[model samples]
Target chain A: MRFAATVEVQLRPGIADPEGATIDKAIAALGIAGVSEVRAGRCFRFTVEAEDLASAEEVADSLGERLLSNPVIERHLTTIEALG
Target chain B: MSMRVAVVTFPGTNCEHDAIQGLEAVGAEAVFWWHTETSLDGIDAVVLPGGFAHGDYLRPGAIARFSPVMAAVADFAAQGGPVVGICNGFQVLTEAGLLPGALQKNAQLTFACQPCGLEVAQTSSVLTRGLEIGQHLEIPINHFSGSYVCDEATLASLEANDQVVLRYRQNPNGSVANIAGICNVAGNVVGLMPHPERAISPLLGSSDGLHLLGSLVSSLPAHR
Candidate 1:
């Protein structure tokens, strides 16, 4: 079976987000009021060949831990879906 | 025989030449080692120079940390071989888990490149062996992701262990506690954002970096 995986990595809460803050300032500069804030993160998409969706999720989780995201500062969320 | 310093070069590393020249200037024989090499035989010490390795993609140092040579670097460091990683090289060491903490984008979200003042915080690390605590040095830092961040527990441990070797006298990148450099518990491995190689000669601006790099050379085992 084939599965599509989406990995999202974001800086952990309490870590200062200078890039995000800059983007938020830009929005304010553009007169976009009522927008409280903005946070930035990365998204990775890939397809994995595995025996089943569960196994594919496991692979994605491992990849997320080992490569895609740094456990020290970033948190990774992985989602897997069956590919028809 | 002179000390053999392997200046590891990743695909996008642009500072290997500077590292070699600077090391040679300090009387150590330096050679360029490709990132793909798995071992560092006959190498007395290692210097991972600055520059945008792997083009700084997927975050700085993230990709280069996985290079084949990094395993050898980890092994070399484990056995107490001195290793000093500068600027982008520092990022690689942290990403490779050889050092603690992480470097983030400068708090201003702008690239910072200029000579800055640093205070020696520790005197026993391989990179500061010849320097006295509180001694000041001017070193240049060039990077966008040079702001250092780490957990509070890690910071406490580093302080207690005397692992924080350098602190910015005037913080340029909003680094927590103005930490400009640090080392592992063993003191053999050090990672810092400043460019010691670029500051080695008087004609190249400030020569204060030589003091730090010189300390590294002095820490090496005389026979090795």
Candidate 2:
């Protein structure tokens, strides 16, 4: 089976989100109202081959830590969906 | 009378030449080593110069850490051979798990390029042995993601072990604890954001980097 996985990575809260802050300022400059905040992160989408959804999730979880996101600064969440 | 230093060059690396010239000016024979080569033969020291290795695809140093030469570099570091990573090289070292912490976007959210003040926080590492603790240095920093970050526990450990080598006198990049550089527990590996090779010549603005590079040379094993 093939699982389509999306790994979302973001800097931990309390860490300075300079890029996000910059974007927030830019948005404010555009006269957009009610925009309370903005934060920046990256999303990695890939397909993993495994026997089942559990196995695919397991593989992605390990890869998310080792290669997708650095645990030192970024936290990651993984979502896996089986593909036909 | 001279040490052999290998400056590893990844595809996008642009500072190896400066590193080579700087090391040679300081009485070390520096050579360029391609990232594909997995050998450190006759090398007394290794340098990872600044650059966008592997186009910094995943993150600075993330992709480059898997390069073939990195294994050899890791082994060299394990054997107590001095290894220093400058700028992007520093990022790679952290990504490779050779050093603690990680480099994030500068707190100012801009690419900073200017001379910054540094304080020697440690004197026992291969990268700073020539200097006394609390010494001041003016070195150039040129990077967007140079902010050093680590967990509280790791920061405490870094301090307890004296692994923190350099601290920004003014904290230019919002690094936790003002950490500008750090060494591994073994003291042979060091990673920092400032471009020491760029500070070797007085004409280039300052000669403070010579003292740092000189420390690496002097820390080498006898008869190298």
Candidate 3:
């Protein structure tokens, strides 16, 4: 099965996120309304070949820990897409 | 006798020669220790120089933590000896668990290489003896994974122990609390993202790093 993975990365607390603040300012300028907070982060979407959703999640977790994300300031969350 | 220092060289370490020269300039007996070595005999301090060890493969400092040279460094620190890890060396230290927290990628997803200025938060450790709290200095930092981070409970402990050594004046990376450097629980091991050796000479447009290296020499006992 072709499993889709979405990984979100965020910096730890007390860490300065100037880039994130910049993005927040830019989004606010658009006057989109109702979006009070926005933190800058990395989003990676990829397709993995796996037997099941759990297997895909396992691969996604390994990728985040080993290559896609740094476990230090960046905490990665993986979500496997539900079958359409 | 002067202090005996060893510069451990892991595979892919490009800053070994520069680090050795920096130590030699200040009259420390600097020797190169390969990653394959197990023992660092007769050395008062061990410096893990900044470099792209293991090509930063398997995550920064991931594979290098188990290197043969790191075992020697672990033992050296256990004996109350001073250990300094700069840049990639800092990454290795975190991976090896010699220090707390870990280094993450820049939030902007850029490889930042530039002069980094920081304020010293504490100076009781062997690596920071010559600095003053809130004192300013410059060092050149070149790396992608330089963001320092830890959990809340650990952060509290670091603050309580006065282990936070250096903090970025103007944050270059999204490091937790702008923490550029920190020490171990016992204050013997220090790891920082900036390359102090790179700023030791004015020819590179900065001599502020001399304070960091100089502190190591100055902290030595009269007999060491």
Candidate 4:
């Protein structure tokens, strides 16, 4: 089976997000109201071949834990879906 | 006999030559070790030079940590062999778990490129083996993601273990505690944001970096 996975990686809470802060400043400068906080992160989408959906999810989760994110400062959320 | 230092280069690594030159200038024989090789045979020490390894994709040093050479580097470090990672190399060490903490984008959101002052905080590490506490040196730093970050608990232990090797005289990247470099608890491995290789020549502004490199060369066991 083929499964598509999307992993979203973000800085853990309390870690300073300088890029996000810079974008937030730009947003305020553009006269956008009520858009106060912003956070920056990366999203990775890939396909995994596995025996089943559970195995595919495991693959995505392992990728998120090992390569897609740095456990020291970043956390990742992975979503998997079955593919034809 | 001259100490043989392996300067590992990954794809997109641009500072390997400079590191080689710097090591040689300090009287060590520097050799190139490609990232695909998994052996550290006869290597006295290892240096991971700076540059955008793997094009800085998925964050600096993230992908490069998986290179085959890293497994050898880890084994070398585990055996108490000296290992130093400068600039982007520092990011690789962190990603490889050879060193603690991570390098984030500069707090100012700008690339910093300038000679900066650093104070030696620990003299037991391979990089600062004979340096004096509070001794200052000028070295060039060029990086955008050079800010060092770690959990409070890690910071506390780093302080307690005398693992914080260097601190900036004036914070350049908003690194926690103005940390410019750190060593692992064993004191054999070190990672720093400053480019000691780029500062080896007086023509480049300061030769103070030699002090650090010299320390590493001198600390190596006498060749038998």
What is the per-residue lDDT of model 1 for residues B1-224, given as tens digits with 9 covering 90 to 100? Answer: 78889999999999999989888887888999999999999998999999999999998899999899999999999889999999999999999999999999899898999999999999888899999999999889999999999999999999999999999999999999999999999999999999989898789889988888788876765224
Q: Model 2 over residues B1-224: C-alpha lDDT tens digits?
A: 68889999999998999999888877898999999998899999999999899999999999999999999999998888899999999999999999988999999787889999999999998989999999999999999999999999999999999999999999888889998999999899999999889999889999999999888887865224
Which residues of candidate 4, in runs, are more than 4 Å off? B222-224
Error of 1 at B112 (Å): 0.6
DockQ, candidate 2, vs. native dimer: 0.90
- The pairs that clash in candidate 2 are none
- DockQ of every predicted complex: 0.84, 0.90, 0.22, 0.89
Stretches of candidate 1 exceeding 4 Å from the true structure: B222-224
User: Of 2 and 3, which scores higher on TM-score?
Assistant: 2
Please report the candidate that would top lDDT against the real structure. Answer: 4
Q: Against the true chain A, what TM-score does chain A of candidate 3 give?
A: 0.78
List the RMSD of every prediction in angstroms: 1.2, 1.5, 5.3, 1.5
Instruction: Give the Å error, residue B28, model 1.
Output: 0.2
All candidates' lDDT scores? 0.92, 0.92, 0.83, 0.93
Query: Which candidate would rank higher by TM-score, 1 or 4?
Result: 1
Give candidate 1's root-mean-square deviation (CA, Å): 1.2
Which candidate has the highest TM-score of all? 1
What is the DockQ ranking, best to worst?
A: 2, 4, 1, 3
How does the DockQ of candidate 3 come out? 0.22
- Which stretches of model 3 miss by more than 4 angstroms? A1-84, B221-224
Clashes of 3: 2
| Residue-by-residue lDDT tens digits, candidate 4, A1-84 | 899999999999999999999999999899998997699999999999999989899999999999999989999999999997
Error of 1 at A48 (Å): 1.3
